[model samples]
Target: MKNRILSIDVLRGITICLMIVVNTPGSWSYVYAPLKHSEWHGCTPTDLVFPSFLFVVGLSMSISLKKLNRDNHRKIRNKLLKRGAVIFLIGLLLNWFPFYQTNIADLRIFGVLQRIALAFMLAGIVITLIQNTRSLILSLIALLLTHWSLLYFLGGTTPYDLESNISGTIDIWLLGSNHVYSGFGIPFDPEGLLGTLSSAAQVILGYLIGKNTLKHGKPGTKELNHLAVVSLSLIAVSLVWNFVYPINKPLWTGSYTLYTSGIITGFWAILIWVIDIGKKEKWTLPFKVFGQNPLASYVLSIIVVKLFIYVFKINGTTLYGWSFKHLFQRIFENHLASFMYALAFTFIIWLFAFWLYKKGKVIKI
Candidate 1:
């Protein structure tokens, strides 16, 4: 609590809340446009949530890495591997949770936590190895540009088109058909292996921002002005890049990374100005609670949703069963019920987190 940055926690909390909102929409067919991810080669608000989470991961890494004064590189490496593996396994388990599905061979292997774990490990290793801001920046640029080049050149004639893309091809070959997403009628996952390279860069960028901000503590008007300048520059670059590459989440396009990173940076600047500089904490308490115990809140929400759908079996129907989800569908008799049900579920989870916070219980990895 003492070393925590209120603004960072608030950002993380807001992201988690939005993740639940976008993820648990009453019905996929009726979701608002912004809540749905882009079909293939464009972005929706939902597309930003995962990258924003990755950015925040980088921010948290900055803090953690800064505090590690020990020179035990081996120990740090082991810790990163262990933690990353654990987080990735949790995500995988959640994907195959209850572990009783007959289609076990076709279960998804990569997901949100898996992406986070991979990104965190890669970014941590990079930060550990580079040890210089300028070099880190160069590395990020190199990674992004290299990815773009590889996708463009190696992908050959039908670049950016979903069916023939190298990224998807590699994923299928490596992860196998059963382990990849068939939602698009092919074996592809948005969080697939190649896409994760850019994701790691996203986290690295966050680490850079956090490290700089902490170094320039008690950000004055001058620091705020500098942030504004950087944000604007990034937006301008992102806009240009979007024209060339397009903002795509499934592909994890370079433009999408820049665009989302710019937005998050701008968002961070505004929050810092308003809350940290303006000294406003009262309005941020709810978010702070979730932020402080995000993993607990997220894992608990998933468990609760599963339990409600499985153990409770309201009216002999699964929570997500056509009948149960439809009960509210009939009550509200529209998309609104689905949305409200999801919101209520989210709120219940928040209340649980708040209760835990009240008891001074914070779960960590």
Candidate 2:
């Protein structure tokens, strides 16, 4: 078997880096358009991050599941179930962590890790059930179409307004009132239940793409060309789909899936061309380290930042108060300064990831 692709690791690491950059902005209002999620009915560069992350999970599964085939089916299923449950629970715990400030009784039940866990479990079971590429492709198509049908035909009782879409209504009914994202001033979450089906499909699409890339023995110019062709085809299809469905992340619309998946495929194709085929080494070292220990870096980054802000009270204020973010805002008081603060914060997190890499300590799930 071919060893793990360094390019894939770098790609995953880059996605995680973008995730941190977007999520930990110094001031949300001043962020660049590419780093911001779309306000309503379209996909943005930032909208691609979550789907790209899930796609990487699928790419990883293509490798991991192949190894697990040596074991009995029951054992594999048990392991998948247990691992998925544990990851999902960890996500729930993170949501409620430092549980004093917020109401712990009804914390957000759905989050990044929870979505990952569910997508992994569902996609894993499907892969196990149907052991061929054609089946996987068919399943993905079925999921996307079914999800589209559900959302379109099962229009909300309140009408198909922008604010009261079918996805939000379903989430509100299923998740109850207390657990939805209030940031939108409505009972909806971009990572809601109905949208998860399409998210799982996104992962499956990644798995299919990964299987194709790996089927060729080595990364070659011909393979890169083929990848480019596939990427272009997906992008064309996604554009066509977007007209009818609208690329809305909140709804997790089918068009949104196609659009993000196209972008993700295009991104990996370029990375494979540059890093794998071109044999570029120098620029990728930091990303490779981050990729090697992504989950650990992500969780630790959040916890460490929160802890620092909580513990190091500076001048009757938190460490975050003394942060470049606040300092820049106080001095410049403009969007540009806010943008710089975000970049600095991102750099700091990267340094932390690099430090862990130097120690050769990677945390895995």
Candidate 3:
């Protein structure tokens, strides 16, 4: 408990809150531009949400994997494997929820949680194997470069093309067209397997930051200055890389990974300065509640939304539709109404999270 970082928890909570808002808009058709993910290339506020969550996942791992060493590495690896498997299973189950929406054979095989699971497990194992920070940095660079090489060399003329990108090609080859996501007007899963290379890099970056933070006890002015320099450097390099590689969130490009990781690190550094140092903890209560049980809160939000969309109805309209039509849409513009519904939905989930926090419960995944 002494080593627990409030800033990390608050950051996790912020990410989850935004994840719900962007994900469950009253109508996907009416989302604001910032709320929508970039169609193919470039980054958006929505694009940052998932990667930010993954970055936080990496930070948490810094603490969790600190005990790994030659003596107990085997046991630790097995435990990480189990945890990652369970998380992946949860993501799979989420995709297959209600079981009637899609044919079992054609169900999506990868999603946000699946990506998180893979990134965490893969990054955890890498960190375990390479305990030294210098080696971990080398591994992170290698992961990014390798992902870039594979996509550039094998992805045809338009390497980062949505339809022709090597990442999607790999997904289709491994998971089959029917088993992949078809949202991009093609069977391409953005959270596909190949993207995990860079995703793991994102986690490793977080781990490196966390490891450094823990090593120094708690962050201070010196740590903040160092973090700011490193974060800005990553952003600068990513921007330069974008000229050639392009910053594609769907592709989960190496540039995108670096950009998001840098942005998240800077943001976390600010949080540490404000919350951890300035002692401003009162406003963080709601987010702390959300952060403490992030996985459970996220899963519950998904299920609750599903119930509204898939099960409950009002006068022949799905509950989600009915509520949006009556509660918010009737008063506000379509876009604002859509956003309002998402906000209200998030608040509902927050209530559930707050109750858990009040009960002194943390539902570990």
Candidate 4:
């Protein structure tokens, strides 16, 4: 059980590392196609990172819930709500960092951590209030199905189209185009309002998976086989679902959620089998460091990266650009150099994470 849980942490560590790598390319223009998100529909390696983190969050939540008493339902609910709000607010801080530099009304209202906080809180509430894997699973399906129906009916003729999707409309309607992400060359927040339903569903699925894992015996062939069977079943379902709705990370499409989470669940199953059952432990430290302080790592990575990206100039460019221009770009081709810069930046953050892990300073919320 201990080994299996450690494997979860390792998987989480791996996810955070990838998150850093994907988010911190030396130059967006130089990134490999795989490192970039899909233009509209379908999934990419980069797309998997956020969902994978949510999955790990679900698993972690399950483990944490075991420490709490369902008998103290009110207390548990309060703690979960407070934690979610704090994390969500922290994300808001990151979004608003270097504050007063930009208009407050024009600041982005939703972001990575905000989505995570909302999802975690909602999923935690559902799991706590219902207190059963079956109810969690049902709610997960209901959320996904509800999203599909909303997109199909309310999205006009081209419901899933990039520019015209209802999600972007809602962002403009509520937060306004100036306050939403302009990276798409349109006002679209990938982590938008209605998408929260599917995001929460991902966490709920993870919690149920974790709960089911505990109900089964310890980490062994039986658990592995069970996960494998479920993985295969879900892959089949997702593939079929894709034909009807398409798998899109931006919309948090139902098919995308199923396919990515299924594949990640299968991948983590192998990770557990190899690291836990196989008893291989040497290469696990760095990831454990990342997993130990995911929120701190996530928040710090964004804050520091944004600082490097925005402030401090050398040779008439941001420090990050200046570093890449002088260092990695000088040694490697554009694509590889861009990748190397991201990797180096990720490592720099990892060092701090390692320091925190060593000091037992895992920051929650």
Give the TM-score of each candidate: 0.94, 0.92, 0.98, 0.96
Which sequence of candidate numbers ranks them by TM-score, best first? Answer: 3, 4, 1, 2
lDDT (Cα atoms) of all candidates against the true structure: 0.82, 0.78, 0.91, 0.87
Model 3, span 1-365: residue lDDT tens: 67679999999999999999998999988999999999999999899999999899888888877777888887887888799999999999999887788688988999999999999889888987888899999999999999999999998999999878888888888979999999989889999999999999999999898888766677888888888998999999999999999999988999999999889989998999999889899999989989999999999998998889888988889999999989898999999999999999999999999999999899976
Ranking by lDDT: 3, 4, 1, 2
Q: For residue 200, what is the lDDT in candidate 1?
A: 89
Displacement of residue 106 (Cα, Å) in model 1 is 1.6
The numbered model that scores best in lDDT is 3
Which model, 3 or 4, shows the larger lDDT? 3
For model 1, how does the per-residue alpha-carbon lDDT over 180-252 read when each residue is reduced to its tens digit? 9778877778888888788989999999988888775545577677777777887789889888787888888
Clash totals for all candidate models: 0, 0, 0, 0
What would the per-residue lDDT of candidate 4 be over residues 164-275, giving only the tens digit for each residue?
Answer: 7888898789878888988888789899988988999999888878778766435687888888987887778999999889999989998888898899889988987988
> lDDT by residue for model 2 over 1-365, one digit each (tens)?
15689888998999888877777766666777787888888878889888888899888877766655534656776787788899898888777776664586578888888888887787777777776789889999998998888887877653234576777777778878688777787767777777778888888888888877787555677777777888788888878988777788777777888888888888888888888888887999878877987887677666756765666677877776577446787777566666677667767777888888888777766
Clashes of 1: 0
Which 10-residue window of candidate 4 scores lowest in summed lDDT? 210-219
Better of 1 and 3 by lDDT: 3
| True-structure lDDT of candidate 1 | 0.82
